[model samples]
Target chain A: MSLDPQIAEKLLSEMRRGAIVLAVLGQLQREHYGYSLRKNLVDRGLHVEEGTLYPLIRRLEKQGLLTSEWREEDKRRKRFYRLSTDGREIYAQLMHDWQLLNTSIQKTTGRSE
Target chain B: MEIVDSYLIEIGQHLPEDSRQDILAELKVTLEEEIGDRAAQAGVEPDVQHAQAVLQRFGHPLKVASEYRPVRYLIGPDLYPAFLHTLRVLLTIAAVGVVVVSLVAAFAEGWQVGVWSLIDVGVSLLFWILVVTTGVFVAIEYSGERLGWYESWQPRRLASGSLGIIDRGDVMTNLVTEGVFLLWWNNVLVLPNVINGDSGSFVFNLGQVWAAYFWPFNVLVGACFVLHLYVLMKGVWQRPSLVLEIACNTALVAVLIVLVTSPEIVVVANETAGDQSEFLTNLVDRTLRISLLVISGFCVWDMWSAWRHFKGASWRRSSAA
Candidate 1:
């Protein structure tokens, strides 16, 4: 059965949001500019666009989870973003939470026998 | 070729600003390549009309363009929260800036005089420039590209810049002039007393400080020249202003003016008064005088340069407007 476009859009949007949160937490430990971060995410199998990357970087910086500075690279300038101390702590916790959830779901399905 | 090219251009019109060219190029190639595939798949003659219809049925040009692009959000899940947070910080800073300005004016000098001082003039000029520039860019970027609040408005030709001309000689000459003028201003008018000092080193000395005090006009003239050079280099003839560039230049101009011209030098010197050593008083006086001269010169130069550089540029009216 084909799904309605509206329902498909909503479901895909939620999935995308969850993916972004995970992707951001994973790569932000080291500094990366928006373009580099997008490339990194794409390399890791998470396709992201320039629009999404920049605003996300800004948001993360504003939230005290990231810090950024303008740095010279290849004789051009780029703004590099890195995880803050609090961000590192939060990211670790988030990973732990994700693992626990994944294990619990697997066990519940395994027990359905 | 002419008929095929027009068809391709029509499809190009619907693509987003950032990826329009790339997508168009890819589509053109795909059409050329896919013509063979379609002819083979259906076993038809190399009919251009059939190929065109097949491409059309695969999707509308805009829809196909969207599919090729990776998913993006302007005010996406990642950025909206941060944006709201930034808004709070900016509002707080503005409030604090206003209170500080008022307090400084009330306590330092007559309110009316303070209101009309050169410092006040610089601050107001900077404030309006930032507000107006940001507003205009935001409005233009959004409307021109049909971008949503959080969508990226990447222009198609960002790599080469938006200008039609590619004359390197003109740009190089401007930069050389700018750098030379900057070095001259710092070395000469601002440090006259250093040459006059006992050791004759390029550093500051007694006769230099007195000379600096005597030649306040030189400070403004030198500063004006340096500032013009910087404006020519940074704004008029260089790369376009990205978002980060705009933020930095705005903040730098505002902070520099406030720090340089507040008569804070006099205040600091006065605080060091009542010391027993007459030599200390002289040192404080000299330091304040020299610093004020340097700062005033720099400010005047920047203001003059910004005005002059922008006035002469092709985009002068648009930028100023």
Candidate 2:
């Protein structure tokens, strides 16, 4: 059965909100400026709102989970972000926990490999 | 370029002064890159239309600026209960204080003042009180520091003892009634036509005794109102509030004692055909004495209760230590 469009949108939003932090952290493993990072994420089938992504990037940098520096690129200034040491440590732990939870959920739902 | 400048200006208006320039520069660069990328895909040079489209997709200036700004509140959740408690207490005292002042003014001046004028005074008092209370809470919220005194508190500290919880409803009722009595006592509201007996018409007036003690009486009531506000903000019957309460109640009791012992505080001015009778005068004197006694008794009870709470709070602190 097809889901109601509003309900589908709401569900998608809720799902995206939970994973966005993890997804952003994963992408920042390599250095990328704001515009390029957004394009890369969209190419990978995770469409982040520009308003949402910019703030998240700034917050992560503030928390010391990401490090950013402004550099000249194509004759324009661009702030590029990359995962810090703390970010890598946190990402590894979060990924491990997420994998365990996913496996357990799959087993409980009788969809185990 | 004009549209971009205006858009940036709009966003800058919403942003904090410290970070406005830096944030705007970053936003401008990102917008330009997006516009250029879009133009490249459409096989045209970036133009005003492309800039507008990119800015549109980015969202409204307020929405964009809000994302950068931290969430803020006038009174956050942590202080909300205390704020609400303080508001109720202030409103209650204001309601009572205005009424008392109005009644006293009315009686001293005469009962010629209209009801609407008295109501306007009461409303204006309440509005000012609300504004003052909100301003205080906003100041506390922005300070962004939790009260240092409460840092040592833990739920487990009260495990072996029972702390007195304030009943908001009961306190509110008491405050409202006190406010009304204050208005009545002050002569802000006057009973113009209380009785229309067969022999004569009776009007209410302040007795000669009220004029001599009016300032002292008002000062005592005002102190009590301030103490209640302090207690509301503290959200508990702390030592300071309890001590203030005791002092205020003692003053009130002393004043009531003087009023009751003296001959009369309420006078009935009869505007009728017949002369005023001795019996009616005696009755009015007796009623005033009885009312004073009741109020004094309430004050004594309040003092006793405050003393008990003061001791209890001290005991808990000692034991917790």
- Using TM-score as the measure, which candidate wins? 2
Candidate 2 wrongly placed segments (more than 4 Å): A1-15, A96-113, B93-121, B147-188, B191-321
Model 2 / residue B249 / CA error / Å: 28
Q: For residues B1-321, what per-residue lDDT tens digits would candidate 2 score against the true structure?
A: 678889999999999999789888888898888988999999999999999898988899999999998889988988887777677767766665565555665667765344677678768877888889888889988988665435766776442333455445545555555655556556554445465567876665668987877788667776675666555544566555567778988988988898888765767676562565556666667876898899899889888877787677778789989
TM-score for each of the candidates: 0.27, 0.56
The local lDDT score (0 to 100) that residue B209 gets in candidate 2 is 83
TM-score of 2: 0.56
Chain B, TM-score, each prediction?
0.25, 0.51
- DockQ score of the complex predicted as candidate 1: 0.01
iRMS values in order, in angstroms? 11.6, 0.7
Best by DockQ: 2
Q: Cα deviation in Å at residue B38, candidate 2?
A: 2.0
lDDT of candidate 1 over A1-113, digit per residue (tens): 88789998889877798669767868988778655676688788887643344446665676798887767776545667788998898888888988888789889889532
